[model samples]
Target: MGGRGTRAVAAVSAAAAVLTGALAGCGPMDDIGLGQSGAADGGVGKGAALGVSPLKNPDGTGPGLAPITTSGDRAEARKLIDKVRTKGRGPKTGYSRDKFGYAWADSVDGVPWGRNGCDTRNDMLKRDGRKIEYREGSNCVVISMTIYDPYTGKTLDWTKQHAAKVQIDHLVPLSYSWQMGSSRWSESKRKQIANDPLNLLPVDGSTNASKGDAGPATWLPPQRSIRCSYAVRFAQVSLKYDLPVTTADKDAMLEQCT
Candidate 1:
């Protein structure tokens, strides 16, 4: 009887040891550092090693969000047309021809080329030219520049050799705007529009001349795939700046955007 009792006691002890070992293998039931399972005390987890927090939830519900709507609206465009009527008439030639043979007027809104040390050509060169190397000690002038032509999808090296190749295109062409509502704008406002980044795009000079102040109804970028995006951006800029769009222009934008 004594022998049998001792064996039973030994068996029970062995069972307890096995259960303790299993529990120890699981480490602890408490939260580990950086929520890593079986991690050493105070150790950061793999997420921290990757420069991210393991506790962060990525569901995109942070702040300043509004519901997105897919519906198209032309209200802003109409409002722009109305506002432009208040500004008074724009230039007569509508930036078609300058005395200098450039497509743009020699002066916009009485701000003459090289007047007050401001030249439209130089201004445009500074505005559109990329990788610009400035003339020494001249804050307002660029001696040489480079640009990527969105219209042609080509990078143009615009040194003095190809200075004329890079043209500043009006997003709302001057002629088109004149017909729509610019015919009534103050000279200052007209000048503002002429220099406005929203209205300017760098393009091949010849191509821009070919476009010749025409709206979407008549001309588009040479690249057909960009037409929709171009029309939409043009419409948005016009709407933002209170430029007018003719019925035909509106129809063309709608066709492209839709």
Candidate 2:
């Protein structure tokens, strides 16, 4: 692994240790089934008590969205959110997933983990999963792992058979980005944002599905304590892409930190 990849793994390892300890203390919960794909937006549960704060993990190489608890950090989160430009969303007339390139393509450049010999999805899985077991004879294909879902504040032992339990979420949903000026962006730029680790999160699939195309104004992670961190991440992607969020969304982002 290269420096970025190493850093990503190291970051996740540290977070996984914390979550694993938490799980050990609480004991495993009953299998309540799993969702298909999604993040952030969901019902409340155990909080993601430990992980890299978005403020510290600006590159998105780190694991799990930790709660922004300090007032100073919240103020800083708000400052970043304030820098994001706000405007009305555009029409989604011509938008399709294809415009941003194929799902989990490793071909895109200018984003972390791109062209890193692993697809974006697996890169994410490796980044956020613990006790990961790769596919037979394959270093890049993850077959099993334990995922600490920051959105729902739960953890699960996941295998390839139940792959949908975890999802790689576009923090700024692709469709939401489309409406927020991504439609005017170059195809390559769109692909960069689409595959960018900074814009992605691995969380409960159903929670992620609940957040489809919705902005902070309408949807947020069920783990209330991490809302500020989530807002910071949303702003990070917006600023990086030069995409303006909606006025309502920006307001909501600011409110999360305050």
lDDT of 1 by residue, 5-78 (tens): 99999999998987886687533432221321223321222222111110121111111011112233233333
Cα displacement (Å) at residue 75, model 2: 0.9
**lDDT for residue 97 in candidate 2, whole number 0-100:** 99
Task: List pairs with backbone clashes in candidate 2.
Answer: 37-205, 38-205, 38-208, 38-209, 39-208, 40-221
**Model 1 segments more than 4 A misplaced:** 1-124
Predictions in order: lDDT = 0.52, 0.81
Worst 10 residues of 2 by lDDT: 30-39
Question: Local error of candidate 2 at 56, Å?
Answer: 0.5
Q: List the residue pairs that clash in candidate 1.
A: 87-185, 88-184, 88-185, 89-183, 89-184, 89-185, 90-182, 90-183
State how far residue 99 of model 1 sits from its true place (Å): 13
